[model samples]
Target: MIRIKRIYEQLGDDDGYRILIDRLWPRGVSKENAHVDLWLKEIAPSTELRKWFGHDPEKWKEFGERYRKELSEEEEKEDLRRIKDLEKEHENVTLLYAGKDEVHTHALVLLEMINKKSS
Candidate 1:
């Protein structure tokens, strides 16, 4: 199973194989506290796309499309494979992100992509 979670939330046992999916390290979060099993920065939306979206809800749809396009590249394909491998190895795989708006973040889009591919 795939799940989305905010990195700032308290770590829980059910959040198996936590993977940090943001391109940049979240400010003020210590590496030791993150409890992340993997840091797949390569799968994150490109810096340019991230800047363009600017976490604006109005741009969410476009951002998801643009980010999904980015994820279609060869390198991102490998990253998705890695995520799939983790999902197979663990009962639950949580894609962790730092954004405050969980519903509109790239993690949500990525989760949808993963589910689509798995199905």
Candidate 2:
């Protein structure tokens, strides 16, 4: 199974590789503070897409679709392929993002897409 959560969430008892998915460095989080196994910035949506959406709640649905498109376009499929390898070894994989709004963030869309694909 795979899971998604914000980096701010408690990490204890979370037993899987922790990967951060934001392109830019998260707000005030230090590298030491974030117990991340991988920071897959390469899988994040492009800068133009991020700026265009600007975390606007109104654009969330569209942003999700666009972000998913960008993910495929960015050749991040390789990472997905790699994650599958990890899944074979581990029971869960948590994709961590730093977005404040839990509902409208790209991470949710990505989690949906990834889980759907894995299924």
Candidate 3:
């Protein structure tokens, strides 16, 4: 199963094979405290797309579309495949993100894609 959680949240026992998916390290979170099994910054949205979205609810739909397009490009295929591989290796793969807006974050879009592909 795939799960998404804010990196700032307390680590959970079931957060198996945690992967940090943010382009930048989360503010104030040290490497030791992150409990991340892998850091896939390459799978994150491009800096240009991130800055353009700016966590605005109004831009959420377009942001998801743009980010999905970015993830579909040739350069990102390897990282996308890695995520799928990890899901098969681990029972519960938790994707960590630093965004404050839980509902509108890129993790949600990524999760949708991963699950859709698996189905």
Whose lDDT is greatest here? Answer: 3
**Candidates arranged by TM-score, highest first:** 1, 3, 2
Candidate 2: residue 99 lDDT (0-100): 88
* Poorest stretch of ten by lDDT in candidate 2: 73-82
Better of 1 and 2 by TM-score: 1
User: Is 2 or 3 the stronger prediction by lDDT?
Assistant: 3
CA lDDT scores, all candidates in order:
0.90, 0.82, 0.91
Q: What is the lDDT of residue 1 in candidate 2?
A: 70
Q: Which stretches of candidate 1 lie over 4 Å from their true place?
A: none
* Local accuracy of candidate 3 as per-residue lDDT tens digits, 18-118: 99999999999999989999999989999999999999999999999999899888767777778889988988899999988888999999888787767
Q: How does each model score on TM-score? A: 0.96, 0.91, 0.95
- lDDT at position 43, candidate 2: 82
In candidate 2, which residue pairs clash? none
lDDT of 3: 0.91
- As for candidate 1, its clashing pairs are none
Q: How many clashes does each candidate structure show, in the order listed?
A: 0, 0, 0
Best-to-worst lDDT order = 3, 1, 2
Assess the local accuracy of residue 29 in candidate 3 as a C-alpha lDDT between 0 and 100. Answer: 98
